[model samples]
Target: MKALLPTGDPREPVVLADVPEPTPRPDEALVKVEAFSVNRGETFKLEAPAPGDRPGKDVAGLVVQPAADGSGPNGIARVVGHPMAGGWAEYAAVPTDALAVLPDGVSALQAAALPLAGLTALRLLRTAGPVLGRRVLLTGASGGVGHYVTELAAAAGAEVTAVTRDAERGARLIELGAAAVVHDLADAPGPYDLVLESTGGPSLATALAKTARRGTLIWFGQASRRPATLDFFAFFDGPESAVIRHFHYLDADTSLGDDLAALVRLTAGGRLHPEIGRIADWADTATVLTDLRERRIRGKAVLTLA
Candidate 1:
């Protein structure tokens, strides 16, 4: 099996290498990966994988070898979700509890996009509580997680204000049913009932000030890669009451499989859309990885296996 490898040099990072196939444990399922998507976290960590290590978390494919206990799908039942590692290869051995059986109408490309980013968005929105008839402020509204937040928030009937630095992405976000789209915090509507913030640092400060009295704010991603500093007095001066929450997705989480499955059903029903921006052959892994590292992709970039 051929999998993408990091060359350990920052100047020229990734290379495709022939790796041995994986073996499944009794509790795991061996999957023939049909497609996989690149996450920003993977793009940031381009260090060379140690021997027997493969990079990638989100993958969708057919379950070639089911768990011995009959806990996972057998035969050709399609599945999609997170893997501990080695998902970049032609096949992966994932724990049966980590995968969700994908629906008939959803393609492997779309399923591959759902695991990490989609789960983060779903969990954060749930943490923020109901937003059916309230103003919601979403920052970093362009990347993988941001795109899902935009669509899911809109589907929940929230009046969404999507904030993105890219004009093209801003336009596309509105098509996802955002009530309003803007480039910065200054341009968004004030006193939001709920804020789904991904851009930390100064953007978080702005989002805090824009939050309505007694509203909730969920900070999930640090895309800006800056330190977030807030003045204690200014932030809690009693003018507007705010509740802040921080969240990050964990791979060993047991509930993620169920969440990913629900997302797949929603997508197959046309209520959720996971856009695949750049589709490249798996042989061109370096190019797709380069585009993700350079922040050149507007939406999720999927690499297809031949």
Candidate 2:
């Protein structure tokens, strides 16, 4: 099997090399990977793995070897969730419990894009509770997870207000079902019932101020690479009560089946379309990661296994 390995050297270490194909455990399935998406977490993982290791978690592929456990509740099947490594390759073995069956009409590329960002968006939205007929704000509404969050929130009947820095992208957010779009945080209308904060740092603080009294603010991503600091007095001592919440999608206890199903439906129905910015061959994994780290790419960048 050919897999991309991260060299510890920060300057130039990522390279594709032939490696041993992973053997599926009794509870795992061997998948011939068709496609995978590059994410910030994946980029970070590439810089550091267990000595010599592959780095990628999102994958969309066909199951060639089902786990010996069979297709029972705990049986191995076409796995889709997290993998220890080897996602950026032609083959990977993943736990059956982590997999979600790809819907009939969804393509491998779209499936590859779903597991992480879609799961994160679904979990964050659920944590925000029902948004039906409520005013919701989503910051960084143009990135992978942010785009999914926008669509999910809008589909739930929330009057979604998408926040982005690019005016052109803001227009696309409206087409994605955002009730409105703004180019800057300063331009965002105030007092939203729920604010999904993806761009942390100053943007978080600004979004926090715009939240309504007793509103819930969910902080999910730190795109700015800066830690978010909240004003203690502004939150705890304010006349109107507000809650600042931080969410990590991987911590959600529920299975991804429901969210994956919903995302599939939305995509199939044309209500959700993942904006694919770039598609590169598996051998170019390192270059893609470098671009992602430098914030030189847009939307979701997918690596296809040749």
Candidate 3:
């Protein structure tokens, strides 16, 4: 099997090489990977390559074999899965819990874009509790997770204020459901009832200060890669009762299959739109990774297996 492996080289971090095929466990299904999505976090991992580490986490494909436990979809069904690694290959062994059958009308490219970003947005919204008629602030509103968060929050009746430096991407967010778009975090309206902060650095401080009293602000990622420094005194000036919560998608209360099914249903019903910013052959994975790392690509990037 041909797989993209970490080369541990600065100039060529990942190289496609012949690797041994994966053997599925009793509870796992062997998927013939048709497509996969690139994530920003995976780009960071490529910075320090490991010999056998397969970096891909999101994959969509045909289930060639069912789990021996007789769980999950069967009979060569189209499915999307969240594998820990080894997805950027010809096949991957996906755990039954992390797999969901893709419904009719949902293309492989769209399903490939759903797992990480879609699940993250869905779970974060779950953590946000009821959003109806609330003021929501979403920073870094142009990436894969950002697009889902913007649409989901806005659809739930929250007046979403999406912050992104790119005006072009901001315009798309409005179409997705964002009520207002700001070029910077400082420009965002204050006292938001719910906040999703991804870009770290000063943005984190601004998000904290703008959170409404008793409001919840979930900090997920640091796309900026800069560490955030906060003055303990600054908290005193902001809302005294504001809550700062750290969120990870894997820590969600719901099962991955359940959440993925929800997302699939939304996509099938023409509700949740999977924003695919880039689509290309899997051979172009290296270039796509560079584009994502430099923030050149918006939304999710999917690569198809040839």
Candidate 4:
């Protein structure tokens, strides 16, 4: 089997090389990866990768071998999975609990896009509580997770305000159900009941300031690769009842398989859209990683196994 590995070189950080096929445990299924998605966070680890560190999280494929424990999908089922690592390969050993059977009408490309970004958006909205008739602020609203957040939040009856520097992306966000689109954080209307913030740096402080009284701000990512410093005294004039919470998708209490299955069902039903920005053969994994690191691609980038 062939897998993408980190080369530890500044110019060429990743290379596709032949590797041994993975063996599944009793609680795991051996998947023949039809497609996979790359994420921004995964690209950061390639900067200084450890020995034998496999870089991939979102995997979608057919279960060639089911788990011996009789959990998850049965033999030869189409499924999407969230493995801790090593999903950028022709074959992956995915734990049954992390695997979700995909329904008809869901393509592998769409399924591949769902695991990480979809799960993060779903979990963040869950953390945001009921959003009906609420003013929701979404920062960095052009990427994969942001797309899902905008669509799902709007479907739940929340008035979504999407903030993105890209005018084209801003236009698409409105089509995806955002009530309003702003090019800058300063331009976004304040007093938001819930703020889903991912861009770090100064945007974090701005998002914090925009949170309404007794509202919630969920900080999920630092895509800007910069640190955010908040003026302690600034909060004195801000809403004292507002809450700021750091969130990671893995911290959610629900079953991973269940959450993924729900996302797949929504996609199958055409209620949820998995915005795939780029698609290419698995041989071009390095190029895809470069595009993701350089921020040339929007939404999710999916790689297919030829």
Clashes of each: 0, 1, 0, 0
lDDT-wise, the better of 2 and 3 is 3
**Alpha-carbon RMSD, candidate 2:** 2.6
lDDT of 4 by residue, 14-38 (tens): 8989999998889999999999999
10 residues in a row with least lDDT, candidate 4: 232-241
Instruction: Provide the lDDT at 21 for model 1.
Output: 81
Clashing residue pairs in candidate 2 are: 80-99
Off by over 4 Å in 3: none
Collision pairs in model 4: none
Q: Give me the overall lDDT of model 1.
A: 0.83
Per-residue alpha-carbon lDDT of candidate 3 for residues 1-306, written as tens digits (9 for 90 to 100): 999887766466677999888899988999999999999988889898676688889999999999988988767899999999999999999999999999779999999999999999999999889999999999998999999998898899999999999999999999999999999799887898888999998889989999887888899999899999877777679767778899999997789989999999999998899999999999988888888888889999999998
- The global C-alpha lDDT for each of the candidates, from Candidate 1 onward, is 0.83, 0.78, 0.91, 0.91
Per residue, candidate 1 scores C-alpha lDDT tens digits across 146-203 of 8898899888889999988899888889999889888868878678888888889899
TM-score, model 1 to reference:
0.93
Q: Pick the candidate with the highest lDDT.
A: 4
* Worst ten in a row by lDDT for model 1: 232-241
